[model samples]
Target chain A: MTMALAGWLSREAAVIAVPVISLAFGCLVGYLAQRSGFCSIGGFRDFFLFRHTRLLKGYAALVIGAFAAFLVFWLATPAAFEHFPWALTSGLSPVPGAPAGLEAAAYIVLAVIGGIGVGIIGVLLGGCPLRQLTMTSEGNLKALFFVIGMAIGSVIFSALVQGWVVSVMKGIAW
Target chain B: MNKEPEERTSARALAKTPVFVGALVGILAAAVQGLLASAGGPEAYGFCVACHTRDLVNSAVNALAGTSLTVAPISKNAVLPFLTIVGVLIGALAAARVNGEFRVKKGSLTSYAWYAAGGVLFMVFALLMGGCPYRVALRVGYIDIVAVIGLAGIVAGIIAGTKIAVACVERGE
Candidate 1:
């Protein structure tokens, strides 16, 4: 349905409007998340370290809210069903003609490895990315540095490592 | 003469009101966001952390090239999220003012460096997976099973990470 709306709207409007909505959505989520103390990393950390579940409750609420909303949207809109066309494929699938399934698996493996690294770093850094953003919005200068680092790293990845990154990602599962 | 009890009562009342207001604000903000997204605003995401992170990336890339790059179509839909961030700042500030919890705190150099490293790791993983943990949860809510798998991986990683952090702290690192 979102795609359909994108098609219905002029290309310019769709391009402009979609991001506006996306940003708005992010800001709101960040705000609510900060206010509610919803940090998944913190949740796990607190639970494992201190056997506290207060933070975990926030994470649970977020998941529940998201699931309920998703269900209602899926049921209400036929177009939403169309969005999950690739829901059942195993391993990783390429952009059709790019590589074998193994290559896609490689990407997932890299992602997982990277995910682990992110988790460790999040623990050391005092928050996950979402938490960092929320903390930054709440005027924590420390989180601002993390956000800056993310932007810099992403640019560096795109500029220098795009092909290597894609290839390694492709090669692993294959 | 009898100001102590009165002050304590006022403080308790003040604390209770903001908690109530914050909860209402949060739920209302979330519901509004869901409604907008449900009205065909986006796919598997009415709110996306990864996409905004990507937007920041895209913006940086464009700035580097000495050309003003346009915001992507997907990113334009981030209204409530942005406002929410602003609202969060206001809320935090207000709470701090009322409760006197505001203070300037700094971390050690090691902690700062670790934060930078963590930021890089988060960016790389987020780009690869096409979302962050929040987005992963949102994806699951949308019944995207891939996101569910990713969330599982995240949990596993978090557990391992917690163990490592505990070890490091114990070792005085």
Candidate 2:
């Protein structure tokens, strides 16, 4: 599966390009997010609680926009999207972020577990991670703590939780 | 003159709406993949708050302490870890400062502690699902069924969280 990017950089050059590209894109998204108060979890919460569509529209648009953009890019550069329509090609297998060696059922369970955790925490905290990040920048001390916790959590996750979760799953024959 | 000014202000406000921001994020996510897939991929390797944070921290730890902490292959092969989260911090800070919204709001110690704990737990669960809400959107856009399931789980979680929050409020805690 030979993949090619439409970027001007070659594979060797891409190594250096990664951080630069990612950083620039991140800044743009961050700025927009702060200005817009975008929050995915909040979107769902509002709709469910108050029948408000203002924020919900944003979340729905994100999904639709992503699909439209991916389709366009896939058309323009088919090589870049080896599995353009992931469901058709990969079927039940995921996009490779969970602990590997697990079956589809295990991955589904992880997804549900992770998603529920994220959603509940996000709602209780008043926003999603992006919103917390932006609020931290806006001088919200609570949001700042959340960001700090995430940093600490990341290390702990890599060093401990990841192994523990994988082992536990294996133990359960998942 | 007043009417014209109000109309112009409304136009500006439209640009600041979340719908616009969400669309921008989606398009840019695709752009990231289109431009950077050559570097390496797990595909849908686009915008994700949780995974990117994980990449940044783990990679930094690996460098500073010589620990072999795991990170995404894209971040691992790159000359530097993905700096998206750092960029987000800087960008949001800049936006806040420019808009005169950067106030130093303080919180109680206990509140801070809870937030910090929440952050840790959120990161763990988000990673367990593979990415944050944003990444789930991107993955679903890419037509990943697991992400769809994750989305369903998020909805279920939200319902439960809302119920819990309401209960807490009713108890006057």
Candidate 3:
């Protein structure tokens, strides 16, 4: 449907419009998310700190709703999962299990480190990327600074820390 | 204080419900993000906050410095007049306008440092994780097992952070 619509417009317009359309989708989602008070860390934090589950229910809704949407889209077009397509217990699949050998161990370690790191920071900052965007849009200086830090951190990771990470992984194997 | 008329719209009334609003946004996000994911768009490109926004900032920095230090791909080649972040900003701006929720508050430098530190932690480790918390959900929707593991870690980390927050609140007493 999107491609078909894009075909009518000029090439340049189509190119320019896709990202905008994508952002528009994100915008609607972000706006709705903010208005509804759905946040990533807020959900878990509420459940933990206040024993509140309203936000957690929102989180659950996000998960189940998004998963069902993905399944529907996927059933129509299986190629979207080409990078790492979902398997329905297809025993002859190539994707490795998480409990395997050294590579699996490395994945586990990285996944653990990555999740804990983002989770803590997300809780501290009071929002994830989506929430941050909402805050920044509302002209929150703190959110903007957090974004600045994110930019710096991303640059540092790409330019320097990525190499260090590779070395650390190599060391783990050695 | 009586609010502005637009601020009291039916949309706002409907949005107060977490489950309904959440499901609507989820379905909306998933439709675009999931389809694009298969249509050969960027990885998790639909609604990634860190990657898209960071890429925009990086491009601006590079342009100002007269360098092209692209550590990742961007939507520059697309026909959009600006980065996707711009779209988000506009969307958010509009929402804030409607909700009358725009506010700019700066905290003490100590808090700024704390917030920035948290940002660093988030962006740095998210790169390692290959996605942020939302992206983790997106990946899990695709049945990526690695993301499921990351979700566990996120739970643990949230628990740890919650404990710390509680401790700090108690200490302030």
Candidate 4:
């Protein structure tokens, strides 16, 4: 396949392939997500407001489905898991608890603190970025606010807050 | 843990229950994302919203800056995810069209601040947490521990944010 595409994009065919493939892949994910009505915010909202969890069950479907898929793929091609960490590579590594001392402390502090804020804000916002993107395309003009907000918030974090978080964590531990 | 049974309120029959659909979505995600990875997309690029959005923001910023800054280096050399987003829009448009749900419903000004704040918070904490809910799932797919830790915080944050939102609503602010 690489050899076949090399005719047009040269060695850069992989680069060209990324966008085309990403679009096609995204189309499938979005279509499925839409049909399944899978969304974190909607799930949480349903749980909180109306005591519904079927959408949240959709989340369960995602986990099991993705997990099985990754496991089989990894078994077939072990090389993929070799480069990255086990988890990213689709191999599970037991992380039962935090590391020892300051590093553990730092990890807990940052992770828990950041997670709380994100979860709450995400619920308040009514969905995450992916859902918002789905909504934007589906004709929710209100979701555009979220798309812009996510970009602005992320830019600020990348340009500013992320550095501060790293420095603070480093100062506290590793 | 038991509450009122959820109604099949949606127009669709399997409306309330995720059942096989969630797994189906997952299968599709894993297959396509894995195939894309084999084709050269980053492994981390598999079903990520937080990372992709941030990368796009940085890329746009870099293009606007016209000069490199001392900020962190996080963007993929190519902006493949933007196309992925476009594909999402297209897919969503098609899906909504098929459902007869492709119409816009304008919201009120009273909810504007809420919406904006929601966006701001989504970005900031997603950055701090290193992933959003879906991205965290991706992290779990990678078995990343930081995501595991952050998941707790996310639940807490949802509670706190919900409380604040409720108070604001009660006060009519």
Chain A structural similarity (TM-score) per candidate? 0.75, 0.92, 0.75, 0.74
- Better structure of 1 and 3 per DockQ: 3
TM-score of 3: 0.81
Question: Which lDDT value does model 2 have at A79?
Answer: 71
Q: Residue A74, candidate 2: how far off, in angstroms?
A: 0.9
Residue pairs whose backbone atoms clash in candidate 2: none
Candidate 3, residues A101-162, lDDT tens digits: the string is 23545766777898898888788678777777778778787887787788788777666766
Q: How close is every model to the real structure, measured as TM-score?
A: 0.72, 0.94, 0.81, 0.77
**Residues B38-111, model 2: lDDT tens digits:** 77777887899998999999888888999987798878888987889988888889889988989999999999
Residue A168 lDDT, candidate 1, scale 0-100: 62
Candidate 4 residues lying further than 4 Å off, grouped into runs, are A1-13, A83-107, B1-21, B38-44, B67-75, B79-82, B163-173
Q: Write the per-residue lDDT of candidate 3 for residues B14-133, one digit (tens) a residue.
A: 777778766666666656644343223443344556666556665676668775544343244543322556666677777887778888877788877877777777888887766677
Q: Rate the local accuracy (lDDT) of all candidates.
A: 0.54, 0.88, 0.65, 0.61
Interface RMSD of each: 5.6, 1.4, 4.6, 5.3
All candidates in order of TM-score, best leading: 2, 3, 4, 1
Where is model 2 more than 4 Å wrong at Cα?
A: A1-8, B1-11
What is the C-alpha DockQ of each candidate?
0.25, 0.73, 0.47, 0.37
**Native-contact fraction for each model?**
0.25, 0.79, 0.56, 0.57
Candidate whose lDDT is highest: 2
Residue A116 displacement in candidate 3 (angstroms): 0.7
Candidate 4, residues B101-160, lDDT tens digits: the string is 778867877666567667877777766655567656655555566666676577677667
